[model samples]
Target: MSHYAARNAQGHHRVHKNDPEAIAHLKREHHKFRKLVDRINAAKTPGAKRDIAVELHKLLASHIALEEELFYPAVKSRGLADEVKEGLVEHDIQRFLSAQIEAMDIADPLYGTRLGVLGEMLVHHIDEEDDEMFQEAKKLKLDLDAMNERLETREHQLKAQYARTGRIRTPALDREVRARNAV
Candidate 1:
């Protein structure tokens, strides 16, 4: 039996698909993005509005990239194929919206419409991950403590990469981390 299954006395093996630390980080990013969105909507100066919107776009895009690269793959590999697949589709949808948001003119009257659309998509995407994916991941019998440790390490690496290079070094580091931690 796997170490994970061995640790859990239950007959069935447990899997912790989503690490709490990573989920917490994602939630924080969501909150930050929402705040930026609100700030974008409330700003009076076009320059300030545009600047906030641009930064908000970059933040959302990077957060999504990090999640896709680090988080989703780990959860998907934990036997939740359907959930991960759905999440990928949602990620694509969000990416499309992100592109739209990125391209929009913040000074245009239609900007509000695009921002509204982006907000709706973001809210829905976050809700799905938090409610469905997270709950299911929490039930998995995997070593969440170890997973969180790996996530912390990877998040640090990703942060450094983004800081120095301004790009997410992707595909995913999760697979390698998971394999190394595999029972």
Candidate 2:
């Protein structure tokens, strides 16, 4: 039997699939993300598109922080770091594109096209997680309630900071920290 599975009372090998409550929350967030992207695509007014994109960006940042800070570490502890490597890169790519989108004027010709590309990449990334990373997580011995609480706590922290400062962390702050640490 694989390390993640054990013998049942009937002497049959049983595979473990610890479906954390956080997984459900992540799925719901994924659904919301898809809806927001669809709203952006279908919006008739530039103002509406810009508003929805801003909301989407805030939520996306929180979601990414939760995954990076908590969810990915938990999975990586189970010897699945390689499985999540692509996801981390994907997050960085999305963040770069998002920054460009935020700098863009809605009237710019590439604005719609950039949003379209981001939406396409997001859908592809989510599907990849659902198919591969999620399946891998199912085998790990993650605590359902504890994992959920951890995710919620991280999300709450990110959301509150975003509400107060309009961003989780400013690039200037990051650079300052790196400079201070280098001394």
Candidate 3:
């Protein structure tokens, strides 16, 4: 059975299948990204802005990794076909932007413009995920408590692994998410 399907089985009967706690955590991270963007824009020192941008890049990367692994698959399993496809594509776009931001020098004159564009992309992407993907998850009639527990479990696993390695286990999850949808 899928991990999410297992989660659905782990709790009492309910109307939702994923963890609200996980969602709340993700929301906080999204806000952090917004604040990072603000910091990158507001800083007067090039060195400070550059440092902030580097940290922002890492945060965005990890956040995207979590969603791609845990959140999107759950929503897709609940039958959000178009949203799932578009969301993956959106992830690719964001990854591209993240890479660009990572490579560019913050002291360059064009840094703000580049960061602004990336911030705009992120804002739009977050809106779609929260509005469409997350809303679709809420519409699912599974046992929410069970799902949340499973999410917490899965997130714990991911976090533990990240703590050990200081990076995501990307190949494994990439194969898992894509293969799950591909099938």
Name the weakest run of 10 consecutive residues (lDDT summed) in model 2: 3-12
TM-score of each: 0.67, 0.80, 0.71
lDDT of each: 0.62, 0.72, 0.65
Higher-TM-score candidate among 1 and 3? 3
Model 1, span 1-183: residue lDDT tens = 122112222211122344465566665666566566667666776667777866666666567666666667777888888987777667666666766766766677776676667766776666667667777777776555556566667667767877898655455443543454467
Of the candidates shown, which would achieve the greatest TM-score relative to the real structure?
Answer: 2
User: On a 0 to 1 TM-score scale, where does candidate 2 land against the true structure?
Assistant: 0.80
RMSD of each: 11.5, 9.5, 9.5
Q: How many clashing residue pairs are found in candidate 3?
A: 2
| Descending-TM-score candidate ranking | 2, 3, 1
Which residue runs does candidate 2 get wrong by more than 4 Å?
A: 1-18, 170-183
Greater-TM-score candidate between 1 and 2 = 2
Clashing pairs in 1: 14-140, 14-141, 14-142, 15-140, 15-141, 15-142, 16-140, 16-142
Q: lDDT score, residue 19, model 2?
A: 44
What tens-digit string does per-residue lDDT give for candidate 3 at 38-110? 6776777767777787777767767777777667677777798789888787777777677776677867787
Report the error of model 3 at residue 120, Å.
Answer: 1.0
- Ten-residue stretch with the least lDDT total in model 1: 4-13
